[model samples]
Target chain A: MEVRDLNFTYPDGTLALEDVSMDVHAGEIVAIIGPNGAGKTTLLLHLNGTLRGNGVVKICGRRVEEYDVKELVKKVGLVFQDPDDQLFMPTLYDDIAFGPINLGLDEQEVRRRVEEVLSEFRLFEYRDKCPHHLSYGERKKAALAAVLAMKPEILALDEPTANLDPKSVRELITAIKKINEEGVTVIISTHNLEILPQIADRIYLMNKTVLAEGESDKILADVSLLERAGLL
Target chain B: MHQEIDKYAHNSPLCNLDPRMKVISLMTLIFSVVLLPRLELVSFALLFSIALLFVSRLPLRFALHFLKWPFMFITFFLLIMPFSIEGTPVFSVGNVIATYEGLKYGVLIALRASSAVILALIMIATTKFGTLLKALEKLKVPNALIQILMFSYRYSFTFAQEFDRMRLAARARGFNPKTSMRTLRVLGSMAGMLFVKSYERAERVFWAMRARGYDGSVRMLSELKAGRRDWAFACFIIAFAALLHLVGG
Candidate 1:
């Protein structure tokens, strides 16, 4: 996936993204870290044609606008920060099956994928439960599972580990790693600096724009750069 | 989340029964109760509802708790009837006169209302709200209406939780509400904030749905199927309602 000179402003004239540009290779784990009010989420939304900006976003060498919204969604599954937003269906099983069913898959395939992801996230027992009943960590996992059930080539997550306990954070990192090992390119936007080196292959320190982009060690070791981005 | 009835519904002995069957059967019973011409037949309807409540295994106190509101409402109307209708005067209070006809009419209305309410309560208390919505969908209810009901049922708890949190935050700031304009203004602003927040959340939720390939219609994983026992339960309830209607007529 590639974004070139991306610029976006909200309808209220808030300059969200300015000349933002990044490239994510297939089968890579990319992390975009920034403080509050950064444009990380805006950039992720552009990847799946959910938000249109004044730049070009190409997935698999084709411009995002060229593909139908439904087709684009199948290639890039974007998970929101709030599980309540993502899991809007009545039950967890329905939420997981939502994507696959929309993709025009058969009922048997949809059921199989739903069951597979629920078991993978250890959420099989909560299949019939609603999102409000799940714990914060479980909801987060369920949200990711809902997206993964879509079988997207690129999985973009917005703030996957905000407000999580240390244990949940660790488990989420392991889950992301497992997903990455399965060859799905992962893009996460978060300020949780603790797990970057363990999970992220590359880091982009962003504040309304990309301030620094490099290997995780190089980016994490740069104290002055991290401080400049207000991430310290 | 205040889901007392929903909690009971999930754990009730009749929870596993097909919701479509329960809805049809219980609705037929309620119609019979409402259509009964004689007040004497109401006793049978009340007894039938009580039997259903027993079979459901819901706590007696919990089932009766739902009757409190209907009782209060009926009592308010019943209070005016004794003085309004002109007939054989049973008692007199200055210009106000109580009549035996008005008293009997009030009793009949109260019995009919309470019996119907209990039967409706039994129906809802034995089926999960989501399952009930699906039953309604299968029963030829409009899709848009069913969707509205589904969202309202799901998010009412969320909004309640949000309201409680906002109230707690106000209390933490040493805010005390009383019958004053200032209190009203504070509450008004809180409600406005909640509306705005809900709107923003709705927009975000729509985008999330769009990201997951949600077009317009909603699809679910579970399908309801009525078994032999469900048919038996429905047949028995319908037969009992018909019997009551005929015997009363």
Candidate 2:
């Protein structure tokens, strides 16, 4: 994945991202680290065409504009920051099957995908449970399962660990690592810097735009850079 | 209010019954009670609903509590009817007379209202809200209307939680709401803020739906099917309603 000179402004005249450029190699776990309002989410939205900006975003050698929203979603699965926002279906199974069903897959195939992803996330038991009834950690996992059921090539997560307990955070880190190992290029935007070295291969520090980008360890060790980006 | 109903719904023995069958059965009973001219037919319908409440294992106390609001409305209607409809006067209060014919008419109307409310409550108590919404969709209700109902039902709980949190925050700040203009102003602002926040949340929710590849029609993971027992139950309800219609006439 590649983004070049991306610029975006909200309708309310707020500059979300300005001249942002980054590249995510296949099978790499990329972390976007920044303070609040640092345009990390804005950039992720651009990757999947959820927000159209003034530059280039290419996935698999094709510009994002070349793909329709549905086609873009098939290749790039974007999970919202809030599980409450992402998991809108009544039950976890339906939430997971939503994408497959929308893709017009057969009922049997949809059911199969829902079960496969639920089991993959170890959320099989919560299949019939309401999303609201699930714990915050479980809802986050269910949100991931909903996206993973689509079998996207690129998995983009926004703040995957926000508001999670330590145990839940550790579990999520392991799950994300396993998902990355399975060859899906993962991009996560988070302020949680402690787990960056453990999970992310590369880190992009941002404050409204990319301030620095390098290997995860080099970026994490740079106290000055972290201070400059208001992330420390 | 919703939590209590949902709790009973989740635990009801008829939870697994097809919502379509329940809707058909209970709606038939409600309509029979409403359209029946005689009190005996309506009484039969009310008795049938009570039996259903018992069969579903819902507490009678809870059901009666749920009925309280509608019962109040029915009582007020019954109370006014005797004075409004003039007929053979039974009692006079300063020229505002209560008539024998009007009393009978009011009692019949109130009975019909109560029977309909009971039948409707039976269906709600035994069905999960999501299943109920899907059943409405399957019944060929308009998609837009169903979607509206679905969102309202889904988020009312979330809104309630938000409201509680806001109230707590206010109380923490030493804001005591009493019957005063200041209290009224504070509540008005809170409501306005809630509306604004909910509007923003709705926008984000729509974008989230779009990201998940949601089309116009919301599809469920599983389709509801009527089993042998469901069909039998529906048949029994229809036959009983028909029998009541004949016998009461």
Q: Who wins the lDDT comparison? A: 1
Q: What 10-residue stretch in candidate 1 chain B is worst by lDDT?
A: B1-10
Question: Local error of candidate 2 at B246, Å?
Answer: 3.4
- Per-residue lDDT of A1-232 in model 1, one digit per residue for the tens? 9989999999999999999899999999999999888899999999999899999999999999999989999999998998877776667888799899899999999999999999998999998887778898899999999999999999999999998999999898999989899999999999988889998999999998899999999999999999999888
What would the TM-scores of all predictions be?
Answer: 0.91, 0.93
Off by over 4 Å in 2: B90-102, B247-249
> lDDT (0-100) at residue B207 of candidate 1?
92
lDDT of 1 by residue, B1-249 (tens): 464566687778799999999999989989888888787888778877878888888888887787788889989768878888889999988989999998888887878888888888888878877678778878887877877876776677677889999999999999999999999999999999999988988888889989989887676655899999999999999999999978976
After the best TM-score superposition of candidate 1, give how far the Cα of residue B169 lies from its true spot, in angstroms.
Answer: 2.5
Q: Give model 1's share of reference contacts.
A: 0.71
